[model samples]
Target: MATILMITGDFVEDYENMVPFQALMAMGHQVDAVCPGKSAGENIATAIHDFEGDQTYTEKRGHNFTLNANFDSVEAEDYDALYIPGGRSPEYLRLNTQVIGLIQNFFAAGKPIASICHGVQLLTAAGVIEGKKVSAYPACQPEVEAAGAEFVHIEMDQAITDSNLVTAPAWPAHPAMLSQFVKLFK
Candidate 1:
């Protein structure tokens, strides 16, 4: 089993955070979920994003996700893989130099990374997606493309894996994304 590091923060999409956290744990993997400036036992407010036939997805308050590890304690070399969940968090997390550096370490080491939806924002900020084929939320297409990555838009439930990177548009793609990420441990 692999040790996985999942970075998330307040307003992260609920399913995107919890599903992968639990799914990876269920597979007998060790997963540490953390957020910048937060410590073990601290919680982050999550949001539920759902398609309600509106011009865009609708947001609702979701369960509080607890942090099992301290962000300041994370060392990328200690983990075999990285997971970045989508939502509004990436918009701000990407601004943290430590966060971006942490992501860069993963890429420099060639570890597998799985990012979905707006999580690509962090990847772009870290400058790790250059020339990579990625799939992200429709609204993130511009950012991904501008980062020098080829953005592949697909249905929300679909995912695309290119070598050490696996990405999806939204929570609906969790099943595929998780499978691909797990395969990286092989």
Candidate 2:
């Protein structure tokens, strides 16, 4: 079983963060969820993003997720894969130097990475998606292109895999995304 590292922070999408963590564990993979500046046992708030016939998604309070790993102790090489969930958190997480470095290390090691929705923001900030086809929320197309990567406008329920990266437009693509991501370990 692969040991995966999930990087997330406050306001991470509710489904995007919780579903993958639980599902991966149910599949016999070990997933350690962590957040920058937080230690193990700490908790982070989540937000639910729903597209309810509006021009943009609507947000609501979500469950509090607990961190199982310490960010300061995480080493990219210690895990086989990296998972990044999306939400408003990515907008700020991209500003963390350590977070960017951790992402870069994963890319340098050719480790598999599964990122969804706004999660691509971190990848773009890390400069690891250049020349790669990545899928993210529709609003992130500009960021993807600006980072020298081709932005793939995929369906909300679909996912795209390029090299070691598997990405989806949103939580609705969880099945497709996880299926493709797990294959990377094989």
Candidate 3:
């Protein structure tokens, strides 16, 4: 089983962010959840489920997938793959130097990297998606491309594997993306 590290930040899409967990584990890959750390060794995991951005919508209370590990404590060598579930989480993590560096390490190792929706933001911030073709929520396209990524609009159903990177738009493409990620680990 691959030691996969998955990260989530606040305003995360609860369902979409966590859905791939089931798929990954069922396929025999070991998935570990990660998020923003506050104090030393303290991390708070948020959900993307029912999270509404400032644009105005409804938001539901999210799941608390809390863990006790500082981002600095994370070692890229420990994971065989990485996943950044989309939501408002990426926006927050994109600004975190530690998280960005972790992402860089993962890519530097040529590990499988999977992201969905706004999740690409983290990769963009890490400068890992530069000149790479990617797809995300429509609103994220311009920014991703500006960050040196080639954005494409496609269903999130199947995992769009680009090099060691895999992306999807959103829930509509979740199934496929999850399956493709599982296969990557296999």
Instruction: Give the runs in model 1 whose Cα sits over 4 Å from its true position.
Output: none
User: Candidate 1, 51: how far from true, in Å?
Assistant: 0.6
- TM-score for candidate 3, please give it: 0.84
lDDT of 1 by residue, 1-186 (tens): 999999999999999999999999999999999999899999999999999999999999999999999999999999999999999999999999999999999999999999999999999999999999999999999999999999997889999999999999999999899988888885
Best by lDDT: 2
Give the alpha carbon lDDT tens digit for every residue of 6-80 in model 2.
999999999999999999999999999999999999999999999999999999999999999999999998999
Candidate 3 structure quality by residue, lDDT tens digits, 86-176:
8777887788888888899999988888888888888888988887889887789878988988888775455578878889887667777
Which whole-number lDDT from 0 to 100 does residue 102 have in model 3? Answer: 88
Per-candidate TM-scores read 0.99, 0.99, 0.84
Q: What residue runs in model 2 are displaced by over 4 Å at the alpha carbon?
A: none
